[model samples]
Target chain A: MRDELLELVMNKATGRASDEDLRRIDSILELEPHLWDDYNQWHQEIPALRGVICLAAATTEHQHQLPEQIRMKLRARMRTALSRSQPNYDRLMELVNTPPDPQLSWRWAVTPAVSLVAIVVISLVLFNNRPDAESAAQTEVANNQPSEATVSIAPVIQVALLDTVGVTRGADDSTRSQFQKAWPAVEVRQFNSSAEFRDWFIQWPAARGSVCKIFYNQGSGELKLIAKINGEEKAATFALKNDVSELSQIIQQAQARLVEWMQ
Target chain B: MNYPPIERLQSGDSEAWDIVFEWLWPKAIYISRQVLTPLAPSDAEDVVIEAFTSLFERIHKVYSTESLPSLLVAITRNHARSHLRKLSAIKRGYSKTIPMNIVLEEQLPSQEETPLESLATEELFDLLEQIRLELPERTARYIHEYYIEGLTRRDIAECYGVSVHTVSGNIRRGLRVLREKLKYKVICTDDLPFRMRNR
Candidate 1:
């Protein structure tokens, strides 16, 4: 509770406080006059924080060049990585040059063919049910009327398939292509790191309200998948046995479940 | 100076490399110094290099400029943590000395944890310097008297020919300024000096 008050006070000072927060801060200050000293002390520190950040950020512009030795070291490392290409380049090339594993070849070939068929089936269903789709779109449009007139009145279903961490980093090309094939309509975006994905997910404006958020955390050598559709959320966790195959299976399962929920 | 588009950096554009290095390297060093102060300079440099290497491998996913700092810091922090972990493992192999990793990790501030518990006294003093610069001369003096000299409001009021209420108001007003200035950098305030139940 005190933490919440401090947050409110800090927010009020920074001008980020909501009305409720401001009210809370005001009431707290009024009630606990002794606490005012602590508040004053922290409040006074704000300028220093700003100064340090600015000074540090600006100091770089003045005299701090990436030290020559470090730059050289980074360049050499970059050259080495570039020469080697992607970490799995050799493995991928070997897989490409050799015949597909006899056991999986049939499955591999059939996956894309199946996805193509699914895409066609979905398309035909939408086309045949144009009136229904249009009505659904219209209802959606009506529900979002006035403010969203600029949005296309036509109804469209768009789903985003994203990886929160580079859990898919070592995924074989065949796996990637197959996954894309399975979800032809879903727009796929891969996040190579959890931090990158988390930051983007939080700031993503279009994902608010009833949208789906599929989070994948593979940080601790385990795959933890959570699918939040509307207010209901479901999660799965399992130790990743085979990095590539297991991740591929997880993606396929998540895609199937998400597709079911979307349609 | 014209900065290259974020897309170019993501694609391993050679020219964009210089600009990316320039902007991130300093901040990386700053954070590294804070995280690896007791470790060798080489360790901090290694962490920065590791961070950049990871950034390069995953550059394609960095869709925007706004998240660059955060992404860099996260990568740097992870590397630093791992580096410390490795050191701790090595030390445990050889000696009975306390694991340095635990000490370093404890020193590092975590966003998920309470900010107050994590803040070291030196950080507070550093902030005090910033606060002192912005306060009115009289209020700044009083801060030095109260916090530095351990003077009470009554003592300050007696010395300054003001009521205790006036002294409290001056300190509060000065602190309000600091809060406004520092608010952007602060989020979890549970450990803020005034929020302690014992205090």
Candidate 2:
């Protein structure tokens, strides 16, 4: 429970806390605000948990296994290392892996080479038979394949954060909440890219709903803002010049368009 | 973990390698994070993974007294310095002088001892020994699985066929005992001196 409280506050300080954690913190605050006080006093120490004494704290010890995603990456790297370390063995196999009998070995080697020559000969025969084989093949493929719905990728502004640890205090969140207030009846969706939102919009069975997707990079201030309301697509790009008022204007413009679209 | 389960590792036993990896992973990552201070935390994981692979290749050469963390701390710091040097070189190539403070939060630490160094491999085992000796066997095991193995109290309870409360209580009791036993030198961070900050 001590570790739990420490982790909660640590997450909050690092700006990584979830909505659930915020609620939990609310309860903890009412019960023991002193805990936050203790956590805050450390200030710089919070990052390192420095000067703080601990015995079996899981996080402090790094006791947990590397998260599964990282472990899988490590496993892939190890597999590569295993393959790389045995290059000599691979070379040895290449030299002596076939039958020891000279005639049999010769046949074994010749069989694959012969088959490859036949394949090349056949390919050449097929290619020489057609004057416009490449274009004909492409047209054949186009005829056979179904037409895919085109998804135009709209470039939007995304705020690329300078410091992940500190995070963008409230620039992205406030902008999102502003639209939410304007579109009280509309469903707000967050997406990483305009293309993703478009793909989802096309697949929506109930495409009649007033659903919208806003994609903000939350760093670098580059955003790919696109909204699809009632199957009508609207997109606008606002370059973040490190100005909050510019971001506000983006919301205002988006809200203005949304109001017109809804009416 | 105090004394590494390295007999098998040194003898080229794969199972032994796993045990060693499991034991050293947390310790190695913890050290790397400390070494890579004022840098992105994500880089710490990569550094430790790299250190583990390096350590694996050179397992035979490792001395009994050598801790992987201590060995890799210098390497991680060196990596950070080299990375910073590259960043500076890039800035210079563009004929722009980015301030050192803007690029780096603090000057890369030198030979000063970090608190993580205090938790040496031997001391960790010695503490484990103390916990085992001081607490009941079941309580000690529960604490070990919960803390070191990263098991939840609920999971421990289900495994033991007891209520979650029982597991929590036992673990809490064990921690309280260790705190009482260690007294001054361990446990509480309450004594950590407060400092005034501009923020």
Candidate 3:
């Protein structure tokens, strides 16, 4: 069967047989079920050979280049071989044309590193300055109240949260009304204990930035105000703690302070 | 309106670059999607940007505008391969379990015909587009011509002024690289229809 197949293939190659003869050769190979595999394998080598010939032709001059007629003959022979051996030519071409994936680039690999570095640096700066922030809050609370004679109460006074909430005395109804109105906007509610504040902060991370403090003048009623903003230290005292009576007044004062800082 | 010349773009024309980016971005993104599967959709965009950046740096020598798609495809493939390599490294180090999204088959252009029984052709195309951006210029062009354009090696050789053998070799080498790079990411080609698999 191998000898017959070889003879048939050679005959077809040499043009001793017609196009019908080539078809007959294929049919014969198809009929010999066992030899079909070997025939197909042998046929597949044609493209590689054709590739080599094409390479040679590209390198050589006109005289050396295979004539068009001969090239045609060679191509026909190669095609016959390829039909049996080559995996689908169209499929191979498709695989070649398919584009590359874009997501795996070097820029992507380094972006996370850059982002991580930025985050770490920012965190370090914030973390290191926390102690100074606490001290500033304490000082602000101590200095918040000027002598009543020196500074008269303004209709809309801005209040900033400097520290933790504690009971304070001597806040009048007008001050309390101003404070209540301001308190909602600040988004912090006064809690009875430090544990309650901690629990609230745990439940709502947004509350961690809140300012809650109590101020008391001996014999005067205690004033407690809570205000929430971002990135401010917890348990910091405010200077306004002494004068602040209502949530509304505190918010108004805080907004004024924010505006002044911006200016 | 008149458009800026490619030579102006080669000379660092920001407007020309922007025009090039706008025109090619969607196609580049589409090619990336066809090649890369392991990467997220966002990563595909990153690959396109990277490819364009590299192209911009070497725009002076890139002879023809027709070559842009092929060049972009190459960059995408190389980038994606690198990404896959990194992902593999991370996987080995962390033993993390990555979830695979099962892409649904896309509807055909004609509403009258039901969608074919195959893997998501669009998704595969998208992955391919992603991978193309990461590949080198020669390899990506070969792949794009052979697979996306459905051109024969002889035809590609004629177009590029190269031998058919060289074209085939380029394609084969490109495919081999892709197969190695995308081995873990791609499902069995046999599972997909010939059209989708070829894509």
User: Pick by TM-score: which candidate is best?
Assistant: 1
The window of 10 residues in a row where model 1 chain B has the poorest summed lDDT is B97-106
TM-score of chain A of each: 0.30, 0.29, 0.21
- Model 2 residue B182 CA deviation in Å: 6.2
Cα lDDT of candidate 3 equals 0.41
Instruction: Show what share of the native A-B interface contacts model 2 retains.
Output: 0.10
Give the per-residue lDDT digits (tens) of candidate 3, residues A11-111.
34434456786887778777887887545543433332222122111111112222345334323332332233224333322322333234433444355
Ranking by lDDT: 1, 2, 3
TM per candidate, chain B? 0.49, 0.38, 0.45
DockQ of 2: 0.08
lDDT of 1 by residue, A90-145 (tens): 33223223332446435544555677699899978866877887768876877767
TM-score of each: 0.35, 0.28, 0.26
Cα lDDT of model 1 by residue, B1-199, tens digit: 5667788765556667777778778767765655567854556776677677766765666666544554665556556655554454344431222222222222333334233223342343334344445665577555445543467779999998999988867766654554554553344355554232221
Instruction: List the pairs of residues colliding in candidate 1.
Output: A40-B175, A43-B175, A43-B178, A43-B179, A44-B178, A45-B178, A46-B178, A46-B181, A46-B182, A48-B130
- Whole-model lDDT per candidate: 0.51, 0.47, 0.41
Alpha carbon lDDT at A68, candidate 3: 42
